[model samples]
Target: MKYDWILFDADETLFHFDAFRGMQVMFKRFGIDFTEKQYADYQLVNKPLWVDYQDGKISAEQLKVTRFQGWADKLNVTPKALNSAFLEAMADICTLLPGASELIEALTGQAKLGIITNGFTELQQIRLDRTGMSDYFEYVVISEEVGVAKPDGGIFAHAHQLMGNPCKSTVLMVGDNPHSDVLGGMNFGIDTCWLNTQAAQRPEGIAPSYEVSSLQQLQRILLA
Candidate 1:
């Protein structure tokens, strides 16, 4: 392996995060149909919160509770309760991305693997365990626990500390988001690979060491 430590983002990098489907599953308990339009509306509330969370403008607790406040009001439940239930619903529907298993299998034992995700603490381990990917990662860092999100050097610093302060040049950070994953790693003085699965246009001033369309491709390049 080229890297001594390989770090990954959880959602969308290794796992498929279907928030709309998860919302439908969550609202089913309340007898809500949770239409597509409702999901679109929910994204209006959720997306900005994620930006704010990554920007250090909001706490993860605030983002979680605020996003569910409207639903909690309608259902006569606490926002925290709704958030927990939503996480459970998400866990119930979680699955690894295509070739995520193979990529991890190929990388494991060759390099120390770790996860650095902006996702909630409640859902991370459950998804790993459910997908049988728990043992492959030596560290699973959560933004909620770290009090900082990616694109911020603090979270990367925390991860490096957990990794026993490995040589930054020999560490590779891989994720789908160019901003959070690529930019963060670059700013933290580590190499990064952008998992451009959606084929989205790369944003200005954000460059990655490598780019690939899928985990299968990433595995091939890393193990080449």
Candidate 2:
């Protein structure tokens, strides 16, 4: 086989955190009552902060603590209380995406596998262990632990090194995000396969070498 490595992205790419449950449980811990609309509001407020954190503008501790703090601050709640509750809730939730296990099983022994995710090391590891996806990966690099996030060439370079530096052409980077996963792989000279689960249009200029709507599509591509 010409290719020796297959790098994956966590979160929606590998496992989808039932973040709604996480949020609801977290809120309940704080003694705050909220409807689904409020949970959606919390995500809207926190998501951009996470993106900024991934881009190096913030720290993991800040991400964990401040997202809830800021939200509570806006809602006139005690930020400290919310933070503690949020942590507890985040710790409690567990939801893996559809086909996650089957996809990992399908790839086993076919190529060297690893994870390159732009998330906190502790939380991301928890997700993997919780979802039983940890053993499948020989290398798992979280951006916060690595001190560099994806879409930054350094993280990809670091993941490549972790994978023992396979040929760029042969290595395939599969991710759900166009900017981070697709462009990041392009920067590393690795072929990218975008997983567009939502049926979003591929961005205007950037292109992935392969595009698949579901994890099952990967099986056909690999087999063929």
Candidate 3:
């Protein structure tokens, strides 16, 4: 492999993160039917909280709790309870992306693998375990635990430290989010691969070292 280490983002890069489905499952348990419009309303509050979280304006706990506070009030439950149920729902629904297993299997011996995720700590491990991906990665770095999200260099710095400070040139960070994953890796002085399966427009002021539509393509590029 061209890179000695390959780091991945957790949600949507390697596994499906169907937050709407997760929320529906979670709310069903509380006896409320979660509608698309409700989900849209939730996202209006939830998405900006995530942006604030990524921008270092709010802590993970605050984001998690605040996003669910409206529903929590309606359901007469604590925000933490709603959050935990949602994470549990997400974990139950997690699955590897197409070619995710093949890419990991192909890269196993060629390059050390790890995950550097801005995803929550609770959902990550259980999902990894369920998908039988726990043993494939050397490190599963969680921003919730690291106290910093991506696009900030600190989380990547923490991951690099855990990676034993490998030469920057020998590492690659692969993820779906351009700002956090691609730009963060670039700013951190490592190569990055953007998994642009959604085919979104490339944002200005950001460039990735590599871009591929699928993990299968990434496998070809890395092992070429």
Cα RMSDs, all models: 0.7, 2.6, 0.6
Clashing pairs in 1: none
lDDT of 1 by residue, 158-194 (tens): 9999889988999999999999999999999999999
Q: Which wins on lDDT, candidate 1 or candidate 2?
A: 1
Residues 169-217, model 3: lDDT tens digits: 9999999999999999999999999999989999998889999999999
In candidate 2, residue 163 scores what lDDT? 74
TM for candidate 1 is 0.99
lDDT of 3 at 216: 96
Alpha-carbon local distance difference test for all models: 0.94, 0.79, 0.94
Q: Residue 75 of model 1: what lDDT?
A: 94
Q: Candidate 2: where are CA atoms >4 Å away?
A: 71-91
Regions more than 4 Å wrong, model 1 = none
The residue-by-residue lDDT of candidate 2 on 1-224, one tens digit each, is 44578888987888775677777777665576668897777788788977887677887667777667767776677765666555446656756667778878978888888889886665766677777877889899888788878888999999888877776887988999998899989988999989999999779877898899998897678756
lDDT of 1 at 165: 92
What candidate 3 gets wrong by more than 4 Å, as runs, is: none
- Could you tell me the lDDT of residue 139 within candidate 2? 93
